[model samples]
Target: MKVQLLVSKWCPVCPQAERIWTEAAQKVPMDLEVLDVAERNGREVVSRLRIKTVPAVVVDGTLKTVGVQPLGEVLKLLGA
Candidate 1:
């Protein structure tokens, strides 16, 4: 599976979501990519993903969830 976690530094939920993603990613046997919305071209990447909010999880090119989902749920969303 290919998982992308999209977030911005200013987003309150981003950090927590990042932690959750990191943990889940360690368990899932696939590629994990994190896109910081504050990075250059970050906005464009988010827009291409059709994501309207930070702390968004895009799994295998599909929007799974946004904001802070429970770690277990986040893992499930990633198909782990």
Candidate 2:
């Protein structure tokens, strides 16, 4: 699965989002990409997805969650 974790530099929720995804990567079979919304590609992806918030998770090109989610929920989303 393709998982994109979209975050912003100034977003307070980003760090935990990063940590959760990073740890989850070890337990799931997925292509995880962490994007900083301050960058070009990140901005493009976020705009294309119509996501207005940070700490967003995109799984298989579909927006999954827009904020910090429990690890169990994330795993379920990943189909792990």
Candidate 3:
């Protein structure tokens, strides 16, 4: 599965989200892309998904959840 983490450098909680997802990626067999909203690819995702917040999680091209998810929750989301 594909996991896209939509984040912004300015968002306070984004770093934590990134950490969780990065660790989760190491444990799962999925493609994990960390996208910054200020960048081109991230902007496209944000626009396409109508996402208005940072630390958003997208699984297999669908918006799964928003904000900073715990490690266990993230693993569950990834079906790990």
By the TM-score metric, which is better: model 1 or model 2?
2
lDDT tens readout by residue for model 1, 1-80 = 88888888788878898888888878877687888877866676787876788888777778878889887887676566
Q: For model 3, what is the error of residue 61's alpha carbon versus the real structure, in angstroms, after optimal superposition?
A: 0.5
lDDT of each: 0.80, 0.91, 0.92
Best by TM-score: 3
Instruction: Count clashing pairs, candidate 1.
Output: 0
Q: How many angstroms is residue 69 displaced in model 1 relative to the true structure, after the best TM-score fit?
A: 1.0
Per-candidate TM-score against the hidden true structure = 0.85, 0.94, 0.96
Shift of residue 71 alpha carbon in model 3, Å: 0.6
Considering only N, C-alpha and C atoms within 3 Å, which residue pairs clash in candidate 1?
none
Whole-model lDDT for model 3 versus the true structure?
0.92
List residue ranges in candidate 2 displaced over 4 A. none
lDDT for each residue of candidate 3 in 5-77, tens digit (9 for 90 to 100): 9999899999999999999988998899999999999999999999999899999999999999789988887
Better of 2 and 3 by lDDT: 3
